[model samples]
Target chain A: MPGETFKEYVDSFSYGSRTDLFFKWLKGAAEADAEDYIQSLLQELGEVSDTGDLSKFFEMTYEAQLAANSPPGEDPRWKYEDAPFTPLSKPLSEMRVGLITSSGHYVEGEPHAPPELSDYTQEEGTKHIGEYGRAKPFLSAVPIDLPQEKLGVHQPGYDIRAAQKDRNTVMPIDRMKEMADQGVIGEFASMAYSFIGLTSQMRLTREDAPQWAERVKDEGWEAAVLVPV
Target chain B: MSVGHISRAFETAGTPTVIIQSNVYRGRVVVMKPARVVYTKHLMGRPMSAPFDTERQTHVLREALKMLETATEPETSVILPDAYRIAPK
Candidate 1:
């Protein structure tokens, strides 16, 4: 009866399940009451739900949430009339390749910390959302050889637990190194660049991205693989 | 997406880039129009592959890197045949 009551209470929310409510909470939606109710229900049930199911729920609801929250009559997605083309001038085996990831990864003791939204209550999160996009875009250079144990991720946009377990899930630094050693590609760039994926696209396009491009060029990287999470 | 914008910036600056993106954003990726893209059916947080699936991860990386040499023009995109599903225990 308790389990049935808990399930019924969870299904009462607009999103129709506790998992959806959990994702709404994760995304900083103003759902404090729902969050509290879900937590209490979990406590009452005394059962730990499968995280894979939670992740699946988040993926299913993510686009709908974005569509619902977007301002009317405006397409928030980016579009370009033409894509820039820069052909590889040299053989793959002879070029220095680098990696750039929107994984929000940083080595332990690094100066950067991606935005932390999970600690905020719903009211505080609502206030934080306004300023979230304004946060300056930054790139952290992670060394190619850094141990996996030292890697950390802080992107607020998605569930970061997989990346926490194995950063190669996002960055693939180990895979890159293996390729470089095997000559599947040229030398690996000394550093792999990373940034938080949930920042203002306008600032990134107009300002920070160009600078980062310059940094990539200046570093003599001929090609790059961008892994977006 | 930030990766799309950054890839454009990099390519504009004479550095070619290949984007390994999740297929869920294929529509968006087409509009954003980076130099090259390889769409995989992996989950959002694990673009390369599922965690600890080293062989698949390496394969994804290698395939994306190959596009750097093989792509002739901008907006060259491919959807990888690979898919990720959790194995039943």
Candidate 2:
């Protein structure tokens, strides 16, 4: 197909369909020559379009991407047949709650500063996604009293653009305080916890999380709200 | 996924935790199994809603907090009705 024809063909599909097609093309191009892959993809697209049944095609494309992106050797995701539960021993109005976010936020002078604040260029941010499973996991304790102006997010796993404009998008410290003031909850914990969500899951679950639990217990927080980016 | 694991660890350590997450990973959340989960249709990074949307942000937070008192069993999940909107660039 000619370039204009191809563009017209893609434009005919719905927004969701076009996105699925784009990802399919992206995955194919990664393994084959760009020009050759486009020709084959166009032929397949034409076939699928004619059938008016793209569900199977979309499913296969999703599965292919999942398999291609999954880490080598055994599923990396954690699974537990029995999830542990601990009911609140006190009323909501009497319990102290804490905030935990995987938004990779930290104060400007904190020890766990993200690369973006140091030397990583905007282009480098895109490259940082590959560091997901390898990055060292660490936690930052953000004082609830700290000014929002000092807060900065370093999460590369997802778009941090919204967060950069307003930290409350991920960490609703101010809103939590308002709730506390209104007696929705007894009090907001003095410190809010945070860490980069794109780091090694194994290290986070086994090493860092247990310690964080102990810290929460030690600090006398009754419950916590976990916000993931 | 990290949040799910951390919430499990917290519950195991005897500190109750409730997760406020994006619905995009609902399947993953189900498998990882946190004690209580409240999902919002907000975009991945802006889980509480768009930037500076205090009214919507508080509403989401309040819903998650309510799960602490209301969740009676493990793996209890709630899906909020809020729809995801594209964040301004």
Candidate 3:
């Protein structure tokens, strides 16, 4: 095994063998040095060169490497749900519209909730991924007409320079108004909605999203647009 | 992931929603079948393209709004004409 990289050893095995070995490594690493485990795991990603092989490896290890507590045998595939449909009741120029985004937006001087970070711990022969804090939802919506100076964004990772320069890139509330003035949509709803996109907890989202939806429906908006970061 | 759920929430609440996303999400959106999707070949964060380029941003917005009007079936999508080319700093 001298001078052989992780990927080299991984590639020597058949598909089932590789998967079994990957889980063994993942679980053992979690029980040993979690930080070094993640670091070494990421290093192997750079050694694989083929897109198809890389993608397969990623799919195989997604939860084991990331959310180590994900229940085994559960498929993480994005399940398609037949969402309820509503046709445009009128022409675009005559519909009242609202905006929603997962770009971590909130009004200035207002409190915003942060996403729950994973708390990983190793028990005897197992990893215990605790249900940490709840993902903070900006439960209140904002007026679409709010001035750019009065708004704030807390999303990290992606470069925010462009968005800070022009909030239209993420929130687009001002652009929504301009569209209203131009009759592309009849009017902008009095308010728009935002949520931080970093969380993995679906329970909190399931609770918060419907609250906002009730408000949007109450506001009588005929259509809305979801802009994701 | 959250986008599709929220879109479904809006649609279920009787307000049809059009999702504006980057081309990176084409497969996911096609699978989830939001009421309508308008994708831009722009980068991830700047869905409407560059800042202050109101013309291009507006073009993207108009295209998204147009799909809301003209898409005849569920899972329909339109790709805006803009392509993202990252410039060296």
Candidate 4:
């Protein structure tokens, strides 16, 4: 049983899988005004790929993470427009609230928070999310009036379709686009919130939620809400 | 589908389950188990194009769950067609 080699580790994911399009803007992918920045990334690393040090992987992980954590607001990696800036015409009691959480998958040796709130303090995760319970009211209201299938579209990234682990994931995104294109939105953006994986301080989410919030705003949704979990 | 209906189905079938809908983002297969289930693999990236192909995602999830064969209920596949659970988990 030879241990996994550095080359083997790198081979696990394709550039598309490993690369963060939002975090790293390449000139090609999503329209003009975009360019690949891999050259500088390589030059900074001395363009050495075969480094056998596993620690380099950790360093790279952290470096990529840091770049993601504190990115510019104007140039966000999250792929969503701001939620429309309309304060909920209906009060919190009247409007439906959506809760987005951060604890989903916690693989072996992967990062995860301890159960207790105090553990978050010890873990220093509270830095990004001040209080987890602030979002309770919203979480409490889920699976509300909206049709289960229609509401399913809101939790786009969550395992909406995994009802039996035997079929597909939620309302198809392509389907959603078609629905939206077909005037699915009676008067508002049909999809309210896009709950991209909620690793609060993580890069992907930092880009995901803010864009969702903005999308909620831009879409003129009453409130594409989220509650800390 | 209500989480209750999902849970009841599993209960009646007599399996320990985490019945998540791929569209149920909070409990989506990708979000719940991103490592096992690839994101993009979901229906042409209907959700997001982050992971692999849908067939590949299903394959990986099924395989990963297979590892828990000895474990009770044999971790089930939560992702499925966009339909309602007769009951909620």
**Which one wins on TM-score?**
1
- Worst lDDT run of 10 residues, candidate 4 chain B, spans B35-44
Candidate 4 DockQ category? Answer: incorrect
Global local distance difference test of model 1: 0.73
Error of 1 at B39 (Å): 0.3
Q: DockQ of each model against the real complex?
A: 0.57, 0.47, 0.34, 0.02
Per-candidate local distance difference test: 0.73, 0.73, 0.63, 0.28
Candidate 2 has an fnat equal to 0.78
Q: Which stretches of candidate 1 lie above 4 Å from their native place?
A: A1-77, A114-129, B86-89
Off by over 4 Å in 4: A1-133, A137-229, B1-52, B72-89
Cα lDDT of model 2 by residue, A49-116, tens digit: 88855444433443343343343443335767888999999898899999999987888776553443
Q: By lDDT, who's the top model here?
A: 2
TM-score, chain B, each candidate: 0.92, 0.91, 0.85, 0.29
Write the number of the candidate with greater DockQ, choosing between 1 and 2.
1
Q: What would the per-residue lDDT of candidate 1 be over residues A99-136, giving only the tens digit for each residue?
A: 99998787777744434543543234334544546677
DockQ agreement of candidate 3 with the native complex = 0.34
lDDT of 4 by residue, B1-89 (tens): 12222222222322222222223222222222221121121221122212223443333333322321222222223333322111121
Which scores greater on lDDT, model 1 or model 2?
A: 2
Question: Is candidate 2 or 3 superior in DockQ?
Answer: 2
Where does candidate 2 clash, by residue pair? none
lDDT of 1 by residue, B2-67 (tens): 899999999999999999987766666777878999988765566777678888887788788888
- Model 1 clash tally, residue pairs: 0
